[model samples]
Target: MLSPAGDDILIIMERLGPVQKKILLLFHGIAAIGLSYNPRQQIWILKQIGREWNKINQQALNRAIKSLYESKLIDIKESIDGATKITITQSGKTKSIEFKIDEMNIKKPKI
Candidate 1:
């Protein structure tokens, strides 16, 4: 059973486009792998995300990132090396919880 928090996240996610959802979930996955947003690792991280979204164009990715940034769901920083570091904000973390809730499979007991 989903708690109120889980329900709330789902409602929020419904308003986001597919690219935005994937980006949010991708950040969550990156964190799960213990990877920090290092300038040197930015390309690798983006490459991985690109592989998962082979059908998505670069322009779409950029637009989605821009929208997420404008929404304050993520923070983007530019490193001296010109690489952008993206971090999920607290609101983004709350939104990302929808991934876990969606993955849960609760079965009903047969009477």
Candidate 2:
């Protein structure tokens, strides 16, 4: 059972912008890659995704990350070495799955 605050966060997550959605999916992909190979090798540093995307500008990516963080979708942590790590929360995983399902299509056959 989710609290009212959690529900509110979920609503905010559902209304994420295109850049935010892409970031969520990127985090999802990183998790999937971890499971597929060595989990330890799947860490994503902050700004790395933006650099790899090569399309979304840095400011936009930063804004999306901040939004996602506020929505409680992703957790950002900084180590003593000052390396920032981004990990998707369970809520984020659910949202990413929703995005994938929303993109899936089934074609009907005309007999």
Candidate 3:
């Protein structure tokens, strides 16, 4: 059960879970590269990214994808090449920037 404002807040948050944030951040990294999608490659990126950064596993991968899609953070569709393509939406991109900018602002140690 949720109130009107609560539902509105959820709409703004897109109901993005923590795992969904990680997933969006991964797509954000890729979007930074100007190649938003690789029909040739797939969630291999997610698995590799999780392993590199957080040791997130396959179930997490699946759930993250599910959440992101449900939240409208990412779009999944077929490319002209007949492969699946996935990309972060503007909403996802903006949120990812918010997520990572703080990461970049961490104070450095004095030499």
Best by lDDT: 1
Off by over 4 Å in 1: 1-12, 35-51, 100-111
Using TM-score, rank the candidates from best to worst: 2, 1, 3
Runs of candidate 2 exceeding 4 Å displacement: 1-10, 37-52, 106-111
Model 1 error, position 103 (Å): 2.1
Better by lDDT, candidate 3 or 2: 2
Instruction: Select the stronger candidate by TM-score from 2 and 3.
Output: 2
Question: Which candidate has the top score in TM-score?
Answer: 2
Give one digit per residue, the lDDT tens place, for model 2 in 1-111.
757865765687668998898888777766666575554545443245446577777899999999889888899999999999998888888788777643689899999
Candidate 1: RMSD to truth: 6.8
Give the CA lDDT, 0 to 100, for residue 29 in model 3: 55
Model 3: ten consecutive residues of lowest lDDT: 31-40
| Full-model lDDT for every candidate | 0.78, 0.77, 0.67
TM-score of 1: 0.64
- All predictions: root-mean-square deviation over Cα? 6.8, 5.6, 7.7
C-alpha lDDT (0 to 100) for residue 95 of candidate 1: 82
